[model samples]
Structures are given as C-alpha cells and as structure tokens.
Target: MAKVSFDGTSGFEVPRHVAIIMDGNGRWAAARGLPRGEGHRRGVEALRRTVRAAGEIGIGILTIFAFSSENWSRPQSEIRDLLGLLRLFIRKDLSELNRNNVRVRVIGDRETLSDDVRGLLEEAEELTRNNSGMTLVVAFNYGARQEIARAAQRIAEAVVSRGLSPADISADKLSEFMDAPDLPDPDLIIRTSGEQRLSNFLLWQSAYSELVFMPTFWPDFDRTTLEQAISEYARRERRFGGLAAAGT
Candidate 1:
C-alpha cells in the first residue's frame, strides 16, 4: 500500500484505515436532561465533522459502526428514531458526499433490512461507486459473529455444490466471502465513551488493529478528538506478535 503523506511530516506513519465504535449517545443525552433522540441527532453532526476531518487528514478509509444487529433488541420507538435518522442522513447528505468525491460502502445483512432502507443503502453505494476520494464504510445492522457465520455458510454451500473443495478452504479464502471483501482491515479501531470491549463489532478485521478508548461520548467527538486518537495510534508500536522495530 502507498503511504499517505500528512504534508511536511517526514517519516510519519498514518493509519490507512480507521474504524470507530460510536457509543454513549443515550448517556450524553441523559446527562443533559434531554431525550436520547437529541443525542443521536448530535451524534450525526459529529459524524459529519469526523468524515471531513478524516479526508483532510489523508485517511484512506473510514469505517463507522452505525447500527449493530443486537441494536434491534432495543425499544421499538428508539429503533424507529434511529432508522429515521439514518434515512435523513442519506437523503440529505448523499449529494454532498457525492460532490466531495467520497465513496460510500455499506456492509451488513441487507436481506434483513426493510425494502426501502435496503434500497437507500444500495443507492448510496452505487452513486459514489466511482468516487476517488476517501471511502466511508457504514456498518449498519452488522455483527461480526453473524458475518463470520454467513461466510462459513457460503463456503459450505460452495463445497457442497462442487464450486469449491473443502480442502481448499483457508483463512484468506474465507475472508473473500465476508461482507465488503475488498475493504482492507482497519489499522486502528477507536471506541468512544470509555468502552473497553469490542462489543461484537469488526471482530475479524480488527485482529491486529490498535484499539483506543476515548472518554468522550459519540455526540461530543469532533475533529480534534479524532486527531488525538490518531496521535495516540502513532505513538504505539504494532508488533503483530513479533519483535518491535529498533527505534521507539
């Protein structure tokens, strides 16, 4: 992969892909004595800011955890509100994203979504498929366990149908069956709201990702916060179970 130059910074390694677990919307809203819906609304604004910031910082790909499969277990009213916000974001922001040359890619279980929502997700991807700028991957209705299970099922079917031999299955081969197989694994995974757990997001892709847990809530995250996270990532040495480089 070609290294992205952060302008005038000599020998600084930046993460090519960054994934975020946006959390604590409800807590933020509760602290302010406002409804959770308000927190989600503000969270959307934070996302907009972060997207532009990621592009400005030369991040090649930004993947955000928008909705998890377990999120469906939440209250129906809250789910409705969350879905409404998603609709609003796409309908109102798609044009701007396209104009800015940002490509939108959605990964998840699409067959389980409502028809209209599924169409909108596809539209977002199709409209920006040719964009050359930073790619924004939205993980909606996604769960890593479910994704892996689906991949396994596909591999099994291929073997049973004589499309693939069982002996040929390998980790790399199985990865091709995953959602958004073209996307590179995230180099850094940041979880806001001081969360210390993965919470079933990007289990496979985050195998070697540097994890950062920020105390700021999702609604409070901004460009500076993102930069700080990146700086933290840069300070650490990733060994991938091997010895670190000579210098610190």
Candidate 2:
C-alpha cells in the first residue's frame, strides 16, 4: 500500500486503510428504551453505510470489529441474537457486496464455531475471492492477545517440524504468521460512542494508527461521521517516533 501522509500544501489525503471499533450498540438501545438486539440491527445498517462510503472515498481496506471472543460471556439470549444477525447480514448482503466488487476477509479462531457459521463465512470469502476492489475485513470471535499467542504457537511448531532456528524469529517473521499478513496496518482507527480504548482490537497492527473517538453511537454512524473523523486525521503530523520535518 502507498503511504498517505499530510502534504501540508496540497489537499488532505485519504488513508489507505481504516479500522473501526463499532461501540455502544447496547447503550444506544438503552437510551431509547429498546432492546439491545434492536441496536445491533441498526448497527448492521450503519455497517453497510460505512462500507459504501469507504469505497466511495477511495479507502483501500476497511476492518470492522463485528464480534469478539469475550462476547460469549454475555447473556445466552443476547449471544443467540448476535449470531442470528450475523447469519442474516451475510444472507442478505453477501450478494450485494459481491456485485459491488468488494472482497470479504474474516479473521479469528474458527475451529470452535458451529458448522453453519463457519460455512457462511467461507462462502462469503469464496464468492468474492476474485474481487479487485476495496477489501473488507471482519474481526469476528477475535482477540488480539489470542491472535498473538496463536502466532507464537505456530512459530514454535515450525521450529520443531522444519528445523527452523529459534533465533530466526523476529517481529517481521512473526507478522508473517498473523491471520492476514498481506493487509496493511490500519492508518487510522475510529471508535464511536466516545470510547477511548482499543478494547483488544488489532493490538499488533495499530502501533501507529491515529485514533478518532466520537460520541455518536454505532447505530447513528454515517458517511458524515466518517468524514469528520478523516478530517481530524488530516490535520495531525505522524512522526512514527522520528523527529518532525524542518518546517510545519
């Protein structure tokens, strides 16, 4: 991916990759005296809108935190509802996404998922595998710590099986074992509902990502909200731990 830095003279440039932590669905529902499921449904709609807007704005990749491994701790009924929504979203939106030339990629531990859920995810990826447009990454049943641990285990296994030297392991080598090594690290990460933390999303990949937090809930997110966040991103200087340029 090409670097998108602030030129300081030309118009602002769009990020090559943007990741979002869709937060506050339950809180949004609670504020309106509705069930949490309703907020999730609306959040799905917001997701659709965001994907379209990202493509229109020339973003190369967009990653969404759809579900986390820790989400299983929620009420059983709520868990079922979330799963149902995932099924519904794929069934209804998969065809449209494919027609729009969107390539879908799912990352997480899938061994423990039900057969049906796993099938749907695979179908989405297969159907859009040849797409050359924007890539949409869904982090379902994901935990950053778990991902790193899994990579470490794989590296250890390689050393035992292939005689790979333990001393050969480096940060770059470990990254090659991550779920999606081809995708670039996120240039910007946005969280809605005023949240200020990463919440274990993309820990290894977001080392230099500019974060934008908004008070608007997930269900209320739209293209305007995304544009606002990108506008904020354009004003900042990214040194990446180096000294700033000679002049502002």
Candidate 3:
C-alpha cells in the first residue's frame, strides 16, 4: 500500500473504539544495535503520538496492550525496567493528558503491581476520570482469557449469592465484569511489526474488529502509520455476521 495524506478530506471516520498491540520494540532495538531497554524508551514516544492522535482524531475509546501476563516471563531485569518506565511515564504524561483532556484508565489485575506504581496509576486515573475527552486504556499485566474467566466467576458468584439465576447469564451480563464495561468493543485493532495474530488481546470484545497489521516497528510507527491504519479500517467491510451495507 502507498502512503496517503488525509487532510480531513478523506472518507475517514474516527473509530469509536480502537485497540493497539504495540510490538517489536526489542527487535527494533536489536536491529539498531541498541539495548532493548533503549528501544522501550523510544517506544514511549510512539505511545504519546498515538494517544495524542487518537484525541486529535476524535477516537472515543483507545486501548493499548502495554504489558501482558506472559510478559512477566521475560528476564527479571527487563521486567523491572519496563515497570520503571511505566512509573515514569505515568508521572510525566499525566500533565500532558490533562492538557489534552484525555482520561487514563488501566485494565488488568492491578493488585499485582507495585504499591508506588499503583498509587501513581490511581491518582492519574482519578485526576482525569471526569474529563470529557478521549479515554486511553492501558492494559498492563493483562490477559483477555483471564479477564473472561474473572467475568465468569463474577457471574457465578452473583448467581449463587441471592437474586440471580444461572440461566440469567447472557453475553451482555457476562461483559459487566470486564475491566471497563462502559466502553464498546473495539472497532479496529492495529498490530505493529506485521503480526497477524491476536495474542489473546480482547478476545470477546474484538470479535468484530477490523484488524490492521503494519510492518513498521512500534518504535518507528508514527502519525503516518496511524493515518494509514485508520484509512485501512475505513476500507474494511465490517459485516458483524450481517449484511455489510446494513451495518452503520
């Protein structure tokens, strides 16, 4: 595909919900003869650009796959570095998020995170909770299978507790226990570094998402890549198991 410049004239409508799997940081660093941590350090610039682009483009909900549960299997030092980077990112980016009217939200088992990092996460979320702007969801230490399992547990507990019955469980009801129940399913999912698989990201929510895979590494992905992905999404036919034209 060729690069295109969308000066607001393109037939591109901002997706109501978009999710990203930021990949290839370590590979990018290795290719550049730099340490993996240095790659992650540069990747934050891409995160900033993508979030700001989401806001600029009017995307209502944006979810980023920051750290997965499997990521903990990496070398302990690397994991520590990632956590340190996250803490620093939260502290430095909160003000920028406030300036842009973006609200930060985290989806995952946050209890496992360090106390200091958790505090910063909570404070950032609280400060921007009321902002009527784009919602930025960071999935740290997250796994979709675990999320669904947790949702199922919640439903079972409710059924056993008092008024709910096992037969009352439904898809919508099951989704209530998800990390953020208010946000809609992702309309588009972009995976950088040319990955085609989901890697268990938003298994239930992304059932109907249009996927865009880019060869550019996460650290190299820029505003142009964002536009390209959006344009590709615009070209997709999201049937959702129905007539394509019938879809809004």
lDDT of residue 85 for candidate 2: 96
By TM-score, is 2 or 3 better? 2
- Which digits, one per residue and each the tens of the lDDT, describe model 3 over residues 1-248? 22334874635567888899999999999998999999999899899888887777778888999999899999999998899889889889899898888888989888788898778788989999898888899898899999998888788888888669778778888988888998889999999998899998999998889999999999998878988899888888878788767555
TM-score of every candidate relative to the true structure: 0.95, 0.95, 0.94
What are the clashing pairs of model 3?
A: none
Cα deviation in Å at residue 112, candidate 3? 1.9
The C-alpha RMSD of each candidate to the native structure, in angstroms, is 2.1, 2.7, 3.2
Model 3: how far is 117 from its true place, Å? Answer: 2.0
Rank the candidate models, highest TM-score first.
2, 1, 3
lDDT of 1 by residue, 152-183 (tens): 99889888896798879999999999998998
Candidate 2 per-residue lDDT over residues 1-248, each given as its tens digit: 43333334445689899999999999999999999999999999999999999888789999999999999999999999999999999999999999999999999999889999999999999999999999999999999999998899999999999898989999999998898998999999999999799999999999999999999999999998998898898888898988789644
lDDT of each: 0.92, 0.92, 0.87
Mark the 10 consecutive residues where model 1 has the least summed lDDT: 1-10
